[model samples]
Target: MRHATTSDGVRIAYQIEGQGPPLVLLSGQANDHHWWDGVRNDFHSAHSTLTLDYRGTGESDKPDQPYSTAGFAQDVIAVLDELGIDRADIYGTSMGGRVAQHLAARYPDRVGALVLGCTSPGGTHGIERDNEVRKSLAQPQPAARQALLELMYTPAWLATHQGPYNTLGDPDMPAYAKRRHLAASNQHDAWDILPDIAAPTLVLHGTDDRFNPAANAPLLAQRIPFASMHLIPGARHAYFEEFRAIASPLALDFLATARQR
Candidate 1:
């Protein structure tokens, strides 16, 4: 485990595995560094994979306040500075993808390549929740938690992982954990800035991503000057899990090509 202090004095936690060129994994809402457990080993074999717990999640310090994609981007930059890395290939999922887009646009020199998964371009495509889903998100914690679980995972996944989902009620999590999670969920929106990204990008989305429609993938790819799009078949919002076999190869190929460029 490693730690870096952001410009705002927030302590960010991260872990480095394997070796070679640097590759950073940025997770989505309600997730932390451990979210990459399934694919970390594969990524480690080809590059130095750095997985970090964003400020308000995982083992990192959590401060009570609003969270923004801009703040998260700074946290990532701070980590890179602490490690003396000039540039890195970045992979972000959902909300993390928004951060990556902002970083590539705001600090072009720091990004070697970019990959966005299951994310949207903001505006009409980003975070525009259905009325029912929006209402559920506005509810209090107990009810909100149930709504989140249903929305985040498919019925098939829930059927198999019921025990793990049920354990969320263990009551040991810090109050701020839930607070920050919800805060992030409600506050995140970066659709207005997608065009500023210039780094070579690869956008991956599942064909059946009910959370964020698959159309957003093309919308993003079309906006980024040098972006490519890949649609994973038979996958949902959790495309990484369903298309790991294909997605990993595609990611490695894109990173390799981007590095050479």
Candidate 2:
């Protein structure tokens, strides 16, 4: 793992693989760079993929201060700057998608094409998850694992796959950092900044997503100028994993097409 020091003195951990144009991958809330493990190879075939641990997770420094999606965007910028990369295509899922919104808006020239999956805009305008889904997320320990699995995948997927399937994200994260991550995600409000994103954007989500809800995908697409939207049928919150066979190809194609244009 390589490291970058943010202006605030926080150390960010990141890894790079394959070769070609840079493609930065951002994981969801409380998740580390490993969140993209299942699909990294597919992307690597066409791009030099960069995955980073958000400040509150993985090998990055976890300061006691508050976190925000905007702050997370800065962490990404620091990494890109450290590597001498002027611009990169970005693929972010869930909370990472929220961070990408800020990155593209706040630092437009640093980002090229963009892909956002299974994410919400947050705040009053965005769709909120169902109360039961929120309750499942609030559960503790072992129970939280099951709750998350159910929320992440469809019932059909759960019934067929069986065996071990975990979705609780960054098991090694400290309790304090986890709480701060949750708070940062909850406090994210990118609705006003969507139009400011200059990157060619594609918005993707599962038709049956209950975690961030599929409705938000269209909202994102509509708000971000010229952005396109795709909803994978029957997939849930973790569509990038559960339906990677479909999702990854779409993202890769979009990024490639955007690069050509």
Candidate 3:
């Protein structure tokens, strides 16, 4: 594990692995760096990977204010700057995808390539979910996890992996962790800036994703000039878990191609 100090003096924790060109991994909402555990080894073998906790999650320092997508983007840029990396390929999922879009728009020169997974442009068709789930997220802990799990995974997956599902039922996470994550995620609206992304991009989503509809992928791909969309069938919002065998290789291939170009 390594550390970098952002301009605001918050210490961000990150892990660097593998060999070859550099690639940064940005995780989804409410998930720390460990969320990439399923595919990190595969990605590491192909590229030098950097995974970090976004301010409040994992082992990183969590401050009280300024937990917005734009702030998270600055934190990412700070990591790259501290590492002395002029440019890098960035892979972001859900909220991290929103950060990637912001980075590409605000600091285009620092991004070599981009990958967005299970995310939206944050417009009319962007955030679709049950009212109960939203209300639960705004409530408290443990219960928030229950509400989240309902929206994150499909019913079939929950039924099949009951033991593991139960394990994730009440994660040992802090309330402020959830608060900061939600604050950073809820206000994102990037639909207006899609056409400005100049880097080669890949947008991947699951056909069965209910949280952020799969149709949003095509909308993002259509807007970004140099972008392509891929849909994984029978996979839910957590498609990497539902179809790890397929999603892992596809992600690796997308990163590989993006790096080459």
TM agreement with the true structure for every prediction: 0.86, 0.96, 0.88
What does the lDDT come to for candidate 3?
Answer: 0.80
- Cα miss at 105, model 1 (Å)? 0.9
Question: In candidate 3, residue 194 scores what lDDT?
Answer: 80
Error of 2 at 185 (Å): 0.5
Per-model CA lDDT versus the true structure: 0.79, 0.91, 0.80
lDDT of 3 by residue, 1-261 (tens): 788899999988888888888888888876678877767787777789988888887778877775888888999888888889899888898888988999887889998889898988875747566675468766787787766676667777777876454213115557877776777777888888888899899899999777777878988899899999899987777787667788878878987777666
Best by lDDT: 2
* Model 3 lDDT-worst window of ten: 163-172
Among the numbered candidates, top TM-score falls to 2
Error of 1 at 12 (Å): 0.6
Clashes of 2: 0
Per-residue accuracy of model 2 over 1-261 as CA lDDT, tens digit each: 999999999999999999999999999999898888877899988999999999988999989889999999999999999999999999999998999999999999999999999998899999998889878877897787788888888887788887444345898899999889999999999998999987899999999898889999999999999699999999998899889899999999999899999
Per-residue error (Å), model 2, residue 55: 0.7
Off by over 4 Å in 1: 124-127, 132-173
